[model samples]
Target: MIKIAIADDNSFLIKTAQEKLSFFDLAVKLIAVDGKDLIDKLEINHNIDLILMDIEMPEMNGIEATNFIKNKYPHIKILMLTVFDNDENIFNAIKAGADGYLLKEINPKDLHQGILETLNGGAAMHPSIAFKTLKLLRNPQDFENRECQEEIKLSTREIEVLEQLSKGLNYNTIADNLILSPSTVRKHIENIYAKLQVHNKLEAVQKAKSNNLI
Candidate 1:
C-alpha cells in the first residue's frame, strides 16, 4: 500500500483530494490543516511515502514545509497541489525542492499518475507549467527580474477579454459578451498570457492592472 498525506487549509479541498485518492485503493496516513500541522504530524508518523501539498496555507506555506521536509526526511516525495500556477510560485516551489507540480483541477487519473511518477523518481508537471519551467530555465535572469517596469503592449480586444476575465466570467460568457466565437476568445486569452508573461487568468489580470494596461 502506498502511504500518502494531504496538507491544505480548505476542508472542501482536503475532502476532494481524499475522494480522489480513494479511487486508487491507497492508504492515506495523515491529513493536515496547514504546513505547520503537517510537520507536527510527521513528527509522530513519519512513515508516509508521499505528500500532496497545497501552496497557500495559514501558519506556513507549502514551499517552506517542503524545504523542512526535504531536510529532515529526504526519502519522502512532495507533489505540489495548488490552483495558482504563476511563475513566481512555481519557481519558488522548484527551488524549495518539490518533486512534482500539478494543478488542483486535475482529474483523478492524472493525479494518480502524477503521484506514481513522482514515486518513480520522475517529475510530473502540468503541460502549461512544464512550458513555463522551460522558459524559466532558458532565461534565469528574466525570472529573477519578474517585475514588469516597461510598458506592455496589448491589443484593444485583448483588454476587453481581460476585463471580462477579471470579473470571474468563463470563456463562453466572455465570448457572448464580446460577440466573438469561443475559439477567438480562447486565442485572445492565449495572446494575453503570452504578452503579460503570466500562466493563468488571475496572474494576467493582476499583471495588466499593475502595468496600467487594463
Candidate 2:
C-alpha cells in the first residue's frame, strides 16, 4: 500500500482528502497543519511513499519544506496540492523538487490518477500549469535551447532574486521577503545584472523575462 501524508492548513481539506483516499487501498499515515508538522513527522518516520503538500502554510512554506525533504530523502515523492495557479508558485515548487502539481479544484478521480502517475515516476501538472511549465522548459527565448545558452550564467540565489524582481518587487521588499540583509539583496542584484550583461533594473528584468531566465 502507498503510505501517504498530507500537509495543509484547512481541516476540511484534510478530512476531504482522507475520505477520498479511504477507498484507494492506501495507508494515510499522517496529516499536518503546516510544513513544520510535516517535517517533524518525517523526522520520526521516514517511510512515507508520497506527500501531498500545500503551497501556503504556517511557518516554512511547502517549497522550502519540499526542498529540505528532497535533499534529505531523495527517494520520496512529493505532489503539490494547492489552490494557487500563479506562475511564480508553480516555478518555485518545481525548482524545489516537487514531482507533481495538482490544483485543489481537480476532481477526485484526476487527483488519484495524478498520484499514480507520480508514483510511477512521471510528472503530473494541472492542465493550466502544464502550459506555463512547458513554455519555460521547451521554448525559452532568444530562440535558443536553454542548455545551449552560453551567455547566461546566474547563481541560484541570484536567480531567486531576479525572479522576485520580475514580479515587480524592489530590493528592500525582496530583502524583507527573503529575510536577506538589504545589502545582500543589493549585491545579488548587482551580480544578476553583471551576469545578464544589463545595466539597469528595467533592462535586467526585460532581458530575464525575454530569455525566460526567471
Candidate 3:
C-alpha cells in the first residue's frame, strides 16, 4: 500500500477524503490537524511516501510546511490538495518545491491517479489548475499583480453556496439547503475560493459582497 499522510484541520474533510481513498490501494498512515501538527508527527514517523497537504491551516500554513519538508526530506513528495487556486498561491507553492498541486474538488479516481503519477515522478494537477500553471509559467511577472483584471464570475449555484457560507452554515447544512451532495457543496465552495481569491468562508463572503456578486 502507498503510505500517505493527510494534513487538514477539518475532520469532516479528512473523513471524506479517507472514504474516497479507500477505493484504492492507499493507506492513510498519519493524520494531522494542521501544518504544525503534520510537522510534529513527521518527527516521529518520517517514512511516509506522500503527503496530501491542505493550504489553509492554523499554526503553520501549507506553504511553510511544504518548504520545510522539501528542504528536510527532499525524497518525500508533497502534493498540495487545497481549495485555494489563486495566482499567488500557485506561484508560491511551486516556488516552495511542491511536487504537484491539485484542487479539493477532484474526484476519487483522479485523485488516486494523481497520487500514483506524482509517486512516479510526474506532476499532478487538476485540469483547470494545469491551465493556470501554464499561464503562471508564461507570465511569471504577473505574480506581482495582486489584482486580477478578469471579472469575478460566480455561478448561480456558487453564489448560493457563498450566501449559505455567509450564514455560518457548515458543509452538510449547506448541502441540505442547496439540494447538493456534501461533496458537491465542497466543490462549489472551492470554486468560490478560487474565483474570489480568498482562502476561507469569511474572506469569500466579504469579497463576494464587496464585488456585489452575492
The model with the greatest lDDT is 1
For the record, the alpha-carbon RMSD of candidate 1 to the native fold, in angstroms, is: 13.6
lDDT of 1 by residue, 110-176 (tens): 9999999999999999999999999988997776655454546788999999999999999999999
Number of clashing pairs per prediction, in order: 0, 0, 0
Which is superior by TM-score, 2 or 3? 3
Ten residues in sequence with the least summed lDDT for candidate 1: 143-152
TM-score of candidate 3 versus the correct structure, residues matched by position? 0.68
Error of 2 at 15 (Å): 1.1
Model 2 alpha-carbon miss at residue 19, Å: 1.6
lDDT of each: 0.93, 0.86, 0.90
Measured over all alpha carbons after superposition, the RMSD of each candidate to the real structure, in angstroms, is: 13.6, 11.3, 15.5
Clashing pairs in 3: none
Least lDDT summed over 10 consecutive residues: which range in candidate 3?
A: 141-150
Residue 90 lDDT (model 2): 76
The reply for model 1, stretches above 4 Å from the true place, is 147-214
Model 3's number of clashes is 0
lDDT per residue (tens digit) for residues 130-209 in model 3 = 89999989988555443342467678989888899989999999999989999999998988899888898889888777
| Model 1: lDDT of residue 32 | 95
